[model samples]
Target: MPSRQWPNILITGTPGTGKTTHAAQLVEALQSSPSTSSATWEHVNVGDFVKEKGCHSGFNEEWQSWDVDEDKLLDELELVQQAGAKVIDWHTCDLFPERWIDLVLVLRCDHSQLWARLEKRGYQLNKIQENNEAEIMEVVLNDARESYAAEIVVEMQSEKPEDMEQNIERIVSWVQAWRADYGG
Candidate 1:
């Protein structure tokens, strides 16, 4: 694919990792950071997008989440990507083809923190155990590494307020560099 006017950022991780929060902040940061070029940035939360676009087959009782139809979801997002910049927030990353993404941020949190966050969210025992194990095993991180080129994938800690602020600053700088290199 030809270079886009702006980048598509995929924020992925195990469920309690603050992917949504980071994506939202990134979009806002990009918009207000006084860049040289004009841009249209957005946060695309895949779980919500799937349900809104009818790209999910049904709800998964076991996981208490939607059973997304991958093909249908991807088909819709292909059009969305054509528009401009996007910060896609999801628990899975490998499903996205590398060509469609400019950056892959795999957010991670400590297992104890993750467990507490999941519990706070009212996740059931099975769901909580599944996510906690995934975090411990670095499941999302491995998936992101295997799917995208190493240079484009960044692993970041999302455990505290300071970490989030630092992440946003770092990513914004990266975006500025990207825009400069690619004529955004």
Candidate 2:
């Protein structure tokens, strides 16, 4: 893969596992950090990106969500991935090309907490149950592992606020180390 100024990290997990929360905070943290001040980091929410880039085929009534055209979405991501300073947030991970991502953090929440989060969001019963099952099965975690190098994929705990803080600290250090090893 051609080198870039910074890393492209993907924060993925089943719904209600704080993937968006982690992605947003990571960008904010990276942007403010002195070590990575030379790079501009952004939180790219895939769902919104799909709509913005016209990568969706249509809404799915059964799922009550937009049907993502994976090929179109991947095509739209080519340039953005090359830029290489984004925190991409999404539930699905394996579909992204292996080379586009440098790190994959799969946030996992306790089943109870996951349920509460989904419920608090007023998710439909079926949607909540489906996500709960997916989390229990470790679907996203497995997909991330299969999609990226073992060293690049991390399973993170997302049950408490402190976990998020710790993740940011570790990732910041990782960024600095990456800079040491790779020219920006």
Each prediction's Cα RMSD? 1.3, 1.1
Backbone clashes for every candidate come to 0, 0
- 1-184 per-residue lDDT for model 1 (tens digits): 3478777888999998999999988888888878923687889999889989999888899889888899999999999987658889999999988889998999989999999999999999999999999999999999998999999989999999999999999999888888778853
- 1-184 in candidate 2: lDDT tens per residue? 3388788899999998998988889888889998897788888999899889989889987777899999899888988888888899999999988888888999999998899999999888898999999999999998888778899998999888999999989988898888778844
Clashing pairs in 2: none
| TM-score of candidate 2 on Cα atoms, chains taken together | 0.96
